[model samples]
Target: MPKSLQGLTVLVTRPAHQASRFQQLLAAEGAHAVLFPVVEICPPDDLAALTAQLVDIATYDTALFISANAVDYGLKALATPQILHHLTLGAIGKKTAQALQQHGFTAQWVPTAGFTSEDWLALPQTQQLAGRRILIFRGAGGRELLADTLRQRGATVTQVDVYQRVCPKIAVSQLKQHHEQQQLDIIAVTSSEGILNLVAMLDNPAWIKTLSLLVGSPRMRETARQAGFDGTLIMADNPSDEAMLQALIQWAQE
Candidate 1:
């Protein structure tokens, strides 16, 4: 395989816990990855509430996970895997499904293409939901589209937050230092909120607008553009590490 990213420096703005795999991918391509975590994934404020929600897992006919963190924290809170056997598992993204598989669970439904709530909502199985009780496992303060749509379809939707997505205290000087040295080539942002957080963390952020901005989806790309990013915007096929790596390699080759 070709080291397509040789001598390049990419800024990785994923959460600290999830940055390792992407960093390793960049390193394998001979690119330097500068870790600048914009979002911090932390346990929810109330563990008892999370545990209580899972205690009634059998009541819900369907269970949907929003992200990998949701799958991890949600299952961890459950502790008893047998309780989940009654619920039909669903994951918003492939990564979330993989996370469930790691926990000895399988997602019966995953979106066909995209990794957003819209994609999952579009499924035929999700429609005609009259009296199906659904439980959503996700982080705090995410989009309400999934729950709203399900409820609109007459499904009893309950959202149980298992994790918290907090904006970490960021020192943009680390990024600025790389920019000053002209070492920052591209900045990778996974979520729409992450790009917003990165921009908010910087004082001027004009320098970063000049660099290539890599995003996972069109929604995220639009978010970056709305945040005043004027440089080249690269959209990965999906938010997965492999997708982002392939996107970077293809961009470099072109």
Candidate 2:
């Protein structure tokens, strides 16, 4: 007689623009969605620099997109449209490739399994990067692991900053009220940055000691631990909404 997430209250900390779909999916399964957006996705301050990178985009041998956000926001910064037709494209996963399709572009390469840079790097096409020039479109403050690995493989990797993440100023009273009243059941964190932001917002309370946490990956779990949350973290198979919901259901059943 129980729903998958019946009577459970889930707190999702994804960016405001990106939270609606995930909330809808959780709500469909009978979980009460608590929307507390901690991050604001915005345009980078330096538009000129973004345009400068795209000015010579056609010369690059490959262009890599880190996320769907990157594909949507990054391509519009280009100086011209025809340049995309000339370069080989790479997407981190299916959603990003879908975003590219919306933009009338296609990725020649995508990581088949596992949607991380480590997984993408495992592809045979990525191994032969010698003398290749790659343009990476992504948000600011992204990890250097991908670019670094590509450079070490004898590729010229250029990164264009498309968007920036700004942590919003959420009132502590709201979070404390939910925590005090026990309305906040599980907090789903999508990224390492989101994990740290949630820590700063909640101020590392004793409530976290009893709280159930959901992380998109093991990397996020380690980051949450470093942020003073040593509580148990339920990890999703991947970062998609479906995967996170599946993890949530699995945890609830246990």
Candidate 3:
């Protein structure tokens, strides 16, 4: 028989627009999907700073995007294709690079091994950033290590938050009802912030004991552990849809 996740209800906590593929994958293996979209992405409230920074885009030696959302929002704000031809582009992960490529911009640098800030810092291109001006488009409040490390390496890094990620206020009631009914099985968290938000939503330890936890990386797995997730924690090798499905398949087999 096909590997079965029968009767297992997996909670996907990614943004709603991004959860469909993962939900379908789980459903194909007999798992019920509980969509508790804990995070929502919105363009930054104030765009003036971003606009001011972009005015000098041609002056920067490199521009970096840390996430696909950053690429999406950043491109949307630019509203024209001319800005891309002015500078070299760097992406922290394959997904981010792919996003840029889809928008017809190529990434000159991408992390080959791990897709974290530390991994980005270790890349050979980062060694000599002296006098180079780099623009980083990202969500609010994240990956400080990359920017800080770049500064220490002698690069002038200007980071602009093109988007914001906040817990979805609308999902509170649904999440509570699902927990009370014991309908949640596995909780899939792609970031450390998501994990913390999930924990905050639970409100009580009893509610947390009912679900398995799936994470997207070793760093996130460690974060889940630190946050007191006693349930099984399975890590997706990468954040791609295929890697996430493979993780689900492995979990079902065990």
Candidate 4:
């Protein structure tokens, strides 16, 4: 394949653990990957609350994993194997589904494209969730679109935030060094939290304006704009690494 992303230095702002695979994907497209993890995934402050939810996991008719982090943190919180196996499993996207599958649970329902809560709600399985009990596992303080929409559709939605996402503190200095070098070309901002953290981490205003933003959704583009980042907003076909890579290739061709 032609290397369209050749010589481009892209900054990846996902959680550090999750950044490697995406960095590798970018490398395959001939882009230089800059490691700048904005969000750090950690256990929620209230362990007992998560524990209580896991103990009662089987009571919900459907278990929805909001993200791959949710699958990692939520499944790890489970005190028993039986209850988890009995409940119907669903994942938000292909990555989340793969994460669940790796943990020995197959997601019976997964959205084929458009990896968002609205996309999941559009599926036939989710459309029939009326009168059903749905359990959502995600990080603390994210969007309530999924649970709220499910309730409006007549499903009883129970949310259990199993993990917490906070900005990692150490990347600021490294980002300053990169800014001085004018090394960052393309920036991949996956979520609102990541965008916020990235904006906070970069000290130089010129650096923020110089780099083009590769956002997962239009929502993220708005978040980037609000943070005073007056850069080009490039939306991928989907939030997947493959889609972002294709976007990068297209951007290079343009």
Candidate order by lDDT, decreasing, is 1, 2, 4, 3
Better of 2 and 4 by TM-score: 2
Clashing pairs in 4: none
Give lDDT tens digits, candidate 1, residues 77-140. Answer: 8868766767799999788888989888889889867788898998889988998999999999
User: For residues 1-254, could you state the per-residue lDDT of candidate 2 as single tens digits?
Assistant: 76788888998889988899999989888999989987778989988878877888877979999999998788778767658878899998888888999889989889878888898899899997899999999999999999999999999989998999888887778777888897988999899998777766777666764677898888988887777775668999887888999999999889
TM-score of 3: 0.91
**Which residue segments of model 1 deviate by more than 4 Å?**
none
CA lDDT scores, all candidates in order? 0.88, 0.86, 0.82, 0.83
The whole-model C-alpha lDDT of candidate 1 against the native structure comes to 0.88
Tens-digit lDDT string for candidate 3 (1-254): 74477778887888988999888888888888888877889988888867776776777888999999999999987756467777888998888999999989999889887777777877899898899899999999886888888999999999988999987776477777877897877788888888887777656465574468888888888888888888778899976777877897788777
Instruction: Give the residue spans of candidate 2 off by over 4 A.
Output: none
Count: clashes, candidate 2 = 0
Kindly list the per-residue Cα lDDT of model 4 for residues 1-254, writing each as its tens digit.
Answer: 66878889998887888788889988887889988888899999989877976776667878999999999888788887557687888899888999988888998889887688888989998776667998899989978999888898889988988899887878376667876898878888788778887766665366676578998888887888888778778988776777887887888889
Once model 1 is optimally superposed onto the true structure by TM-score, how far is the C-alpha of residue 71 displaced, in angstroms? 0.3
The alpha-carbon deviation from the true structure for residue 224 of candidate 4, after best TM-score superposition, in angstroms, is: 1.5
TM-score of each: 0.95, 0.95, 0.91, 0.92
